[model samples]
Target: MSPLASLTTILTFISVVCAATSWTTTPFNPAAIPLAVRSPYLSAWLAQGAGNALNDVWPTFWTGAIVGWAGFINVDGESYVFLGDPDVPNASFQKAVQKSFEFTSTQSVFVLSAGPVDLTATFLSPVEPSDLANQSFPFSYLALSAASNDGQPHAVQVYTDISAEWVSGDDSLTVNWTTTVGDTITHQVQLEDQTVFGEVNDRIQQGSAFHSTLNSTGTTFQTGQDVVVRAQFIQNGVLANTQDTDFRAVSDDWPVFALAHDLGTISAASDPVIFSIGHVRDPAVEYLIANDATQNRSLFFWSQISTLDDAITTFLQDFPNALARADAFDAQVNADASQISSNYAGLVALSIRQGFGAIEITLSKDASGQFNTSDIMAFLKEISSDGNVNTVDVIFPTWPLLLYTNPAIGKYLLIPLFAYQATGQYPNAWAVHDMGASYPKALGHNDGNDEPMPLEESGNMVIMTLSHFQRTGDNSIITTYFDLLDQWTQFLITDALIPENQISTDDFAGSLANQTNLAIKGIVGIKAMAEIASIVGDTARSSNYSSISASYVPQWQQFATSSDGKHLTLSYGNDSSWGLSYNMFADVLLNTSVFPASVYDMQTAWYETVVNEFGVPLDTRHTYTKSDWQSWTAALVTSTTVRDIFINSVFKYAADEENSQPLGDWYETLNGDVEGFKARPVVGGHLALLALQAVRTQTAMPAV
Candidate 1:
């Protein structure tokens, strides 16, 4: 080959590599996903739009939820109270996140009008529109009242309040309606002050903040061009201070471009927002569900967390005795806080954000008199925070509380583990398939990963089960499931080859053939199982496991390193070409007693090298990293810097960034924008008991 041609080919190859690596998930926006999150509340967001949508931020709950059409969107500025039991079959609140949007467009599809805008909001149920808490009866009002230069009132198009349904069951009554536009605006119209509750909404016209000439609670006005308007209900006097006192309550704004003047010229130059609103049910437990062309659905995490946090705060008001006060809080604060503060809250968050649920239970009971354990393992794995199997086809993974928080978690953990032994039912194996990538739903490639993950999963199960036994000191559960021990051992020996491609949770970087880390994990799993078998007096299997584990150490080292430096590569290459995070768990998670301490140093160095403003990126390629894994990886070492770096990583992702929803999993690194995923249980586990706290065993969850 010619020298110039060779150089040209090399240059082309280098360019291709750079190009592929340069692309962020959504390449255009810098504030795009992959940065860090500034909002911390998203960590607890788990509500799947039960009431109003959630917002993401410190002030707001999650970023704003996509309530409906852009025109009829509500801010995450409202507060939500748990009115009914979330654990109940169907639940609703008397007053929560008090807010709704009603919009109408004079143009094509939006409510914004270039010439004039008038809207009539009919309450589904009304009762003189007096007390704020008296939402039991809806009320009606007119807003966004505007007119043209011709000195004529714009057409008042009235719409129904579709949100005024029963708290749970189907019982929606049309609230009483009233009009206080012209003459009524000058008078109270036998109702409370409009300004007291809140302004209907702030009005603006074509980038112009429209100043209202009419101050009545329900009145109309004339405008020269298309305008924007906001409306809010009135209810603040202590006498009138009712149950529904959230600020998110307000009407929608109609944005339009301009109005045609007598010269036949368009003025103001604002783009009219084309949008629509409608009533619809949630999608079935299926994919590719259709959405109202005008309305989009976005789950809120930030807001959900805040509301939950508020509930917890309320429950903790009588701290040192939350469970003792359960009955009291139950009636006053009630199941709202209890339901949200417990494991269910975490689980709900996980399912929405990541797709699976995991727990670490302590073997103790709370004041509620409930004792959760291994028998409930399968349910624990798929349990949503709000309480139910997710309709979606996926699940997620977790970290410390390393699947070791409460005994309730144990019952859940064992469900899937024993299913494999009893019915050979691999479907609900309570253990994880990998480190959380579309699970429980078991959609897409996750299904293929199961039986294929024999060693990885079997080993994990053995370790977890043994850990549970050590913590609880109960050998009976093990005795009852000895047959599972046999199958698991065989699978580890025959199926656990370590190319790392078909390895455990560490598959995110890509496939590595014959990975040392996995091999070590396998050995540990075998040894741990052997210890269990010995405890049960199964001497034959114990010896076999010990022999295999003893021989595999050298092989682990052989394939993980090449003829280069002492440090390990991402794979078995002389290059030692690396990745964002290092393979530190090689000796750590496996409980390897005799590995080099240098491994920790080298891994920490690798972690440092991958650092970004948001966190250490997934690899050298980009800025974004997973908050959950950062916690897990940090748990392996004892360095405060290591621990803090990972902790701060999660902190950065949680506190700043896009969609300030209370908590969501995926976040951006460049500008701290929230990317995807919300309120996952795995994140709770990741955040709840990181580092040394992992190995410690507590039998039950902390009191509420």
Candidate 2:
């Protein structure tokens, strides 16, 4: 053969090997990593399943009908399933909790409960059963089955709020029921021929679908009034209800309480149920109940979970039984259906989608029995802790709107550590840009406001520094990043004094300098930076920041307040009304360490005057506003009602209510149209849920 022919044969062989290798490589395999120095492929493949499909990936379950999330693990005689935002560390922790149409997992013990009444647990899933023997379970691959609890053949029937129809593990039990929207379903699991709790004394009806019986072991009986339950784990080998393991929460809010270990004299009429939810995951946990009581018919929550934004709960709790919850379940579900029907309706019909929230990251348990990260979930390990992304700009500082209130804070919230990660120059610190593009590739700060925005960015840096310190309870970030903090503090101190030459991101209109609201920006920046000093044990620096900021607060008030003062001038001493957002950006969220609560309330009242249909305008002329900035300051109102209004306004802006498009960050209020800035990504700032959650949990909901 000629030399040319030989070369061609060699090239063809090489091509075949490459193809074969590609075909052999399974994306889900966690071990298949690139070279040591190479960047990670996608954010996550297991948690997300090649979640790098471009346009923000939606979780599998919400995508269509049956998207699976993290699988429930049957651990040492008990089973556990992560409710929302699978810790991404597990291979089974996908966006959707259900991967297969029908899920079946064979195990030993069985447990399931409804609000207060406890019963034999089995088959917790999205789809309801048509019959007791479960002719079919929704989705495929996944299953929850317990062969025999202890020695006897234990059996129980299951039902959901979706429909009264029942499915049973015991061949004889069956229920025929029907329901409509807004209706609730009551499920009972009891021993055969045993009467207990509220139900009338009846020999356990031979074919009774519901059952419950009281046993002496604290929570061994069926009862009402208790909205949550717990599991009892036997250490090593002690069996037969040794002790209560861990309890879950009906509500994952702060300061969750559980019953005492010792049972006092029990009045059969009083406390019937002993089990309680000992833990609760906040912020993210709200998604489990939403505002809907129906959706929560048989809901369960991961306990003791904290959020990046604890504010939303605090905000909502302000109106616990307020009208905010009226038709809440039905309305919300309808809204979701409307939104999905608009655009995302057909998405899952084609293929698997990711879960809700972030694609990477999961909180699971390791072999050590301690809750740790998952091996399969280690998809982005390269970029996770210490990857070489050149830079780490957290663009999606916020995430998953209603679900994730305090979301990411730019993946690495608090520190705003971008340029440091990018240039490998953690000099003073880094400039966090909401988040690094999407994830992992933190190089671009495509926020569009580059070369501009001093107040917004500067103040953010200081507060972020302080918050990070509080969270890690570590002073390293603040201590090392102090010099940079001073630079911003100094900049705010010297330059922002008059608000000249310093335009913040009150992007409703354009950028302006020395604006009245902006003065708060400077004050807050200085105060927050000083907070960093205090966190690092530098009382001197903290005092200095506080004292100086204190002096400026009233001065700014005197200077910015107008004569017939329902509102203040946007610019100091001038009638030129500009963005009122500076009120929120400065005095409210950030300067809390300095100004009195009244100041924020007053400022919020002033700020209220500027709100348009979309939100408070960036200025006097533009009918449009930036939802990012709107949510930013609007959320500072301290009043949950106001915050809810602002939050609702944001939903009004989002396609969730009607028009379905990628979250429109900028829009015109007059006609509710997308004015400009379509899918730029900085809108993640709107996710302040975690941040709000943090504030609420950390501080008392100030007496608004």
Candidate 3:
């Protein structure tokens, strides 16, 4: 009898030996677990649901489009699916029982029981904050290791495949692919006709998707229709080692590239079967520079490496060291965050990957088409909102993670904004809202027609510039952009006091006049400017900015304080209206002392009284709150009890099974349901407490 036909005899015995399935989570259960989240284009997640077992449901792009990634294991003639849904019709192919799931700053691990053997699948997206080359490489790793749970030898084989759905969001798009064999076995898939810098439903319309594994013994490869390929492995414990020649639409026959490894028999854990998946697009962004000429900027990794094969080879070889670095990074973040609370640590761990996933580090090509490594810039997408590029307010909230990880990253993010505005292309006196309306395009608003959040963006720029300088102790950025910094600071000086009707970063909440929270941001911005001036040895401007900011504090208090002096109002003279004074965090962050101890105490006490099951509301106007602002509020509060209260509420919301999407920053505080927004980089603000701690530990300021 064939091996598949003979497996029926042992099916009854295998079923009886298998234990009951149960599920557990380490740290806390997140809404959707990150699978392979690197760049915005390369992100994938496994949405948590009652029926969504690891093998039962397919992994999805962050936008909820299915990206077909499937895995299977054949243990002693019995076949089971583990990582994704393979949709095999055979009655013998069973779904593996997931035992546990855990995540850290850099990796997500899922443990599953496949009959008599146990499988541990780890999805690692390296978080190299200090190492730009490794961080910029658009690849994620999937390592699968198996061992016999019955303490007996068992024949085992592992298989994984990626469908062409990963190449483009539009399933009807025609795709062509090829297989290459050398030091590594790689399958490359791409659209037949590419539209450079174009996107359909946020998935780049250009770029080749690479699914690769080392060309080693016991490994076989195949390409064909998904069902055909998956069934071949189920019937036989190995692949046909052949490529399908047809080039067709992504949805036509559901073409897939697959690799399988045969572990003859295993009593102990077998060596890991590792696969690397990445999407590569040259000339990653279209950027407008000081000369008013548009230039194509490629990913920074291309500058350091000569070829894609070499890049993949080095990346695969560096896995041991890369994983070690990521492990150390996760441990450090956990250690620092646990000092606050275990709940706080979980929040930080969940936010780290989502925060950095929105950014891409790129280098500009010179006249000869050679990438200039020195001309590097980092661009961020205002994901799931408007798709704005390098949005000042978006960066403002995301900067905490950048600041805590590597302050130089924060500097790279700012360079594009400064470079664009420095050319006098932006017609606004205040900072532009964002470099571009959509991501991967940094064309400046030469017509001065960008969205107007004059006071908001102005304050954000000044505060972030100072924050970067404070963390890195690099005064060069301050002196280099002193003129434009003064321009934005001057705008803050004019509008900060009493504040005209304008929208803040929480623009979705709508515009308000004399906004108590917005007014404080501008005031703190002026104070931050004063420090920036001092750092550059501009004593005249330093004293002037200091005097102005010092004078605005008492006036701001008068306009914003409640009748009972127990809390701050939402707007001037609105004694009955109260809101989260998150802007006060910048004062504490900068050590400006602009808002006195009484202000902190009053806000802390009032927040405790008004706290909801999920979190404190953004204001009395709505039950919804912004998680980023709530975290900033948590960092500034003097009461540790109040701090934990805020942290626990956000943590509770994140752990809610119903809140299943990549962490949304805006949600209803009453029910912990997402109100609007998802997968935003602003969730990085969740690390505010860590950034604040780092800043406070600096004993001496950098000399001028």
TM-score, candidate 1, is 0.48
* Best candidate, lDDT: 3
TM-score (C-alpha) between model 2 and the true structure = 0.43
**lDDT (Cα, tens digit) per residue for candidate 1, span 1-704:** 33234334333432332122211211011111111111111111212221122122111112332111101211122211211111111222122221222211000001222223211111111111011111111111112212233344332211111111111111121111121222111110011112111111110000001011122232222111112111111011001111221212122121111111011112222111111111111110111111211111111111122332232222223222322322232232212212223222222222222222122111222245333222222222222222222211112234333333333234344543353335442343333343222222212122334434545566666765665566557776688777776566666666444544563443334545555555555667777777788888879978878777666656655655535544455455535444432224423543544245665566665555545555555543345566655655665655655555555545544433233333555555555555555444446435333223334423332233
Candidate 1 ranges with C-alpha deviation above 4 Å: 1-399, 402-404, 425-452, 495-497, 503-512, 562-566, 579-594, 619-623, 666-675, 685-691, 694-704
Sorting all predicted structures by lDDT, with the top scorer first, yields 3, 2, 1
Worst 10 residues of 1 by lDDT: 203-212
Give the Å shift of residue 547 in candidate 2. 2.0
Instruction: Give the root-mean-square deviation of each candidate in angstroms.
Output: 18.4, 23.4, 8.2
**Candidate 2's residue-wise lDDT over 354-440, tens digit each?**
111122222333455444322111111112212312121222223223122222222233332432333333222224323232233
The better candidate by TM-score, 1 or 2, is: 1
The C-alpha stretches of model 2 lying farther than 4 A from their native spots are 1-450, 506-508, 576-578, 582-593, 606-611, 638-641, 655-658, 678-690, 698-704
**458-561 per-residue lDDT for model 3 (tens digits):** 99889988988888778767888989999999999999988899888888889899999999999999999999988888899899999999999999898899
Residue 545 of model 2 has an lDDT of 78
User: What is the lDDT of every predicted structure here?
Assistant: 0.33, 0.34, 0.87
